[model samples]
Target: MSKSRIIGVILALLGVVLFSAKAVMVKLAYQYDVDAVSLLLLRMLFALPLYLVIAFVKRPKDPEVMKPKVYLWIIGLGVVGYYLASLFDFLGLQYIKASLERIILFVYPTIVLFISRIFFKKLITGSQVLAIGLTYVGVVLAFSLEFSLEGEGLFVGAGLIFLSAITYASYIAGSGWLIPKVGATVFTSYAMIVSCICVLVHYSLVGDFNLMNYGMEVYGLGFAMAVLSTVIPSYLVSYSIKMIGAPSFAVVASFGPISTILLASYFLGETMHWAQWVGTVLVLVGVFFVTKKD
Candidate 1:
């Protein structure tokens, strides 16, 4: 591999690891009695300023103006992708282990494929169908294991995370067209800014605005989550995709569930069953084929 490809691989792996850590961090914050809304609020609040700066600095300089419809698309996708997806993930983590959550969420590629098929009339080959089967079978395997282990809140948490995956996949499906119209950096920054605003608005309506009430540890976790998981990894993944292309980046990103499982084990003391390991492997394999270029 070329030096650029090597660097892209490193960045992709690092970004996946950091992004996986978000679940662990959120789980940690819950120990402080912080609600999902408050924790999500703190995360977006901390990260919002950076996104604003990036949106301004990276605004497209082309003479052509974007249509109002495009702006609406960005806003809608931003809310669905980051705001709602993240809220569901945070709430789900309160019930499920991070390992199981990551495993479930890792199937978004399959969701993306189905979304494209249903909405855009994209054809799914036989292998793609098989890949989908494997992915869901693995998820069911893992979900059953988790449900048995943690009886309370299992269904609700799994349902919420599945919704998170679907909404995120919708964002991915929508953003592909828009990202080229606006540059990747500009599109991502703007989408994130919109997401931050929505999160803030949601918090203001339902959550206490007084963030200072939380202990310092909660703030620290929030800041770490925002900067390390959200901002840095966002840029790293973008740049990695630029360097190595999206196909390679998606393959590299298959390590995400493994990273989360390891992190959850080390940091959160969550143990995985042997069968769950099998499920994780199946998910990784299925998603790999699902995202593999034809």
Candidate 2:
């Protein structure tokens, strides 16, 4: 691989590791009795200013003027990808283990493949079909394990995470073309900013405005999540996509499930059964095949 491709792979891997930490942080914050909306609000609230500054400082000079529909597409994708996807994830984490959540979310590679096939008329190879089968088998295995252990709300949680995967996959598929046109930095900043505003609006309607009730630990975790997981990985994934395209980026990020499982085991004291390990390995292997070049 060329140097830029190598760097893109490294960035994608690092971004997945950091993004995996988000589940652990969300679980930790839940320990403080914070609701999903409140926690999400705090995260976007802390993240909004950073995105604003970056958007201003990195604004492209003499940029190609985009049509109105392009701006609309960005906003639509921002809502679907970050705002709704994140809301589902946070709410689902309330019911499921972080490991299980990560495993389910990792199925986005298959989702991305299908989105490309359906919307873009991309052909799916035989290996890609095999990859999808293996990936879903792993997801079902993990889901069954979680269901056996935690019966209540397991379906709901898994369904929510699956929805999250679809929305996120849609975002990745759509952003593949948009990023090249608008530039990675500009695309990421604007998408994130739009998501932040959507979160704020959502909070205003349904969330309690009394932020003084939560302790500093909640705030600290939120800020850490915003900076470490949200802002940094957002840009890393964006630039990685710009360098190597979305499919390769997804392949590099196949490490996400294992990383989240390890983080959950260490931070939240969540134990992984031997079968769970097997399922996780299957997920990683399947994702590798799904996105790898023939």
Candidate 3:
């Protein structure tokens, strides 16, 4: 491989690992009795300044006037993808293990495929159909195991994460169209900033501001999540896609679940079953097939 290719692979792997660590960090933060919205608020709050800086810095020098519809599209994608998806993910993580959360969230690609088919009238190839089937089968297998282990909250947790996947899929589907128009850096930064504003608004309406009065450990975890999981990986994944292309990064990102599983085991003491292992493998395989270039 060429030097750029090697760096791209490394960046892709590192980005996936950092993104996977997000769940583990959230689980840790929950040890402080923070609600989902509050925790999410803390994360976005820290990330807000960074995104603001980038949004201003990287904005076009000679900005073209955009249609009002384009601004609406960016705002809508931001709400669905980051704000809602993240809220659901954090709530689900309250009841589910980080490992299972990662597994469930990893199915967003298949969800995106279906979203494209339904909304955009994109053709669903035979391989995509098979990929979708395999991905759900794995989720079912994993959900069953989690249900047996976690009992009551299993359905609720799984359901929330599934919702998260759907919302994220919608974001991906919309972003496919918008990113080309907006440019990746501007689209990402602006969308995240918009999402951050939505999160703040939501927190103000329903969340306790006192929830911000936590110990240093909780604050530290939130800071780490903002920098490591949210901001850094965002750029890293974008750069990796720029360097090696999205298809290759998608293939390499299959390792994300494994990284989460291992991190959960070490940090959260979450044990994995054989069924989970099998399910993880199936999901990754399904993703591999779906993400492979034509």
Candidate 4:
């Protein structure tokens, strides 16, 4: 592997690690009695300033490139990608165990595969094909073992999470245009700013803000989610794509649940079941095969 690609992979892994902390923080947020929209609002609110600083420092001229068409795309991407996607994700999470939800959510790799192939006409190689298959099977194993046929709520939740994955995949694929041009920091900042707007508009419409009056702990966890989960990983993944390309980057991201599960075990008192461990191995192997630099 070239040095740059190696560095890119490292950055991507770091992004994954930052992302793994998301569930725990959300779990913590529940103790403070915040709903999803308000929690999301707070997160974006905290991360927006950071993104602005990064955007300004990294690339001032980038904002000038936000043409009218780009603005439309930005709105579409931000609303559907972040605001809606996040809404669906948290909704699904409420209905299922974190383990089950992560399993459903992480199938985003398969969504990315179809999106890249159908929209971008990116051809899949034999190894890439196997890697993709591994990705699916791995996700199924990870999630299915944790899955329960319990409530109608879980089924409904799974559907929403699947939708969340699709939207998130769209964000990943569509974001390529902006991330490379704007630089990771700047693009993330703007996209997040856009998300904050949509969320605020929705909050205003529902009068959810009146219910969202929060104390310090709520604000702290929300900000932590924004900075630790969204902002940091958003920039890191963009940087990874710039260096290693999206397919390779996404393949590495296929390993997201491993870190999440591990952290859950240590901090959340979750157990590491055998199936989850096997799924983690499969994800690592699939990522290795898919991302092996030629």
Candidate 5:
């Protein structure tokens, strides 16, 4: 690989690792008795100013004014992609282990594949079929393990995270086309700002701002999540995609679940059985194939 490509892969990996930590951080913050919406609000609240700064700094010089429809697309994506997806993820973490959540979220690549096929008329290749099969099987293995151990909330949590994967996959699919129109930096920053606004709006309507009066550890984790996991990784992945293209970046991102599992085990004391490990391997292998270039 060329130096740029090598650097792109490294950045992509770093982005995946950082993004993977988000679930772990969420799990940690839950120990403080913070509700999901409040936790999410805190994350966006801390992260909002940074995204605003990025949007201002990266504003187009001779501004390429897009159609109003394009702006709508950006806003719509911001809502479904980050705001809704993040809300579901935070809520789901309340009931699920971080490891299981990551594996469930890892299926987003396959979701992207199906979205393209259904909406964009893209053909599903044989390799993609096999990849989809393998990935779902892996998720089933992991899901079954979790189900056996937990009570009724198992499915509820899994379902919420599964919804999160769908929304995030939609973002991935839409952003692939949208990013080229708006510069990656501009798109990432503005879209994130939109999501931040949406999160704040949601918080104001239903969330108790008073609840934010938590211990130092809660605030610390929230800041770490916003800066370390959210802001930094979001920009890194955007730039990495620009450097290497989405398909290659997707391949690099297959490491997400493994990193999450390891981090969860170390930090959260979450344990995975052998079946879960095998399932994780299968999901990674499947994602590798799903992301393979034709």
Candidate 6:
């Protein structure tokens, strides 16, 4: 690969590493007794202004792209990508094992491939096909090791996570059309701000939002999740999408489970089975194919 391509690949992988740490951090934050709603709200509270700042400064001085259709699409993207997708993920995490949930959500890349093809008529390459195939095999192996069907709730949670993955993948696949018009920095800022507002409105009506109820650890974890997981990684991936395109970027996302597994083992007192190791390797192989430069 050329140096520029190599650099793009490396930066994308770095984003994935940061992305992987998110679940670990979220689990750690929950240790402080914050409910998912409260924690998500807090993360959005902090993220809102940060995104607004980016949007304010980055927007150009020239004639702006201000058609109602564009704004409407942005709103739709925020609702599907940020609010609804995240809501499903957080809820799924409550009922399902983290590992199982991660496996389900990681299917986003495959979903992205199909969604992109249908909506944009983007053709999938041979490597992309192979990468997706390997990813599913890896997902099966990963689940075999950590499968949990503990309750009726597990099935519900799995469905939620699957929906979350599909919605998220659609957002990622479709956002490419918008990113060029708005640019990654500006597009991400608007998406986040809109997403934050949606979550805030939801939480205000349904969530407790009690300041005194949550301890410092909970609040602190919430902020950490906001900065590290949501804000930072989302921005990084936005930039990655701009730099490398969504199809390639989604390939790197194939490895999201690795982050959860390592984190679970370290902090949650969880153990990985032998099949998990095989799964992780298979996932890496898929990631390799997905990310391979043309």
For candidate 2, the C-alpha RMSD (Å) to the true structure equals 1.1
Which digits, one per residue and each the tens of the lDDT, describe model 5 over residues 1-294?
A: 899999989999999999999999999989988899988888998999999988898887754556688789889999999999999999889889999999999899889988998999989998889988998999998889776678899889999999999999999888888887887888888889999999989988997777548999899999999999999998888888888887788899998998999999999999999998999999999998998953
The digit string of per-residue lDDT tens for model 6 on 1-294 reads 677656666667767767667666667776777777777788888778888888899975555675678788888898889888888887777776666667668777677667867886878898889888997798678666444545577677778888998889878866878888877877788888889999988888998757568777877767777887788888888887777777677666656677777777777776767886787677667756765643
Report the number of the highest-lDDT candidate: 2
User: Against the correct fold, how does model 1 do in TM-score?
Assistant: 0.94
TM-score of each: 0.94, 0.97, 0.93, 0.85, 0.97, 0.87
Error of 6 at 12 (Å): 2.1
State residue 219's C-alpha deviation in candidate 3, in Å.
Answer: 0.6
Error of 6 at 216 (Å): 0.7
Worst 10 residues of 3 by lDDT: 59-68
Candidate 2 deviant stretches above 4 angstroms:
none
Clashes (backbone N, CA, C under 3 Å), per candidate, total 0, 0, 0, 0, 0, 0
Q: Supply candidate 4's per-residue lDDT for 22.
A: 81
For all the candidates, what are their Cα RMSDs to the real structure? 1.7, 1.1, 1.9, 2.8, 1.2, 2.7
The 10-residue segment of model 1 with minimum total lDDT is 241-250
Cα-based lDDT at residue 256, candidate 3: 95
- Candidate 2 has a TM-score of 0.97
For model 4, what is the alpha-carbon lDDT of residue 59?
60
Model 4, range 179-243, lDDT digits (tens) per residue?
77656666676777788787778777774554447888888888889888998888788889889
Clashing residue pairs for model 2: none
Tell me model 3's lDDT, rounded to 2 decimals.
0.86
Give the Cα-based TM-score of candidate 4 against the true structure.
Answer: 0.85
lDDT of 3 by residue, 223-275 (tens): 99999999998777766766776557778889999999999999999998898
Off by over 4 Å in 5: none
Residue 105's lDDT in candidate 6: 81
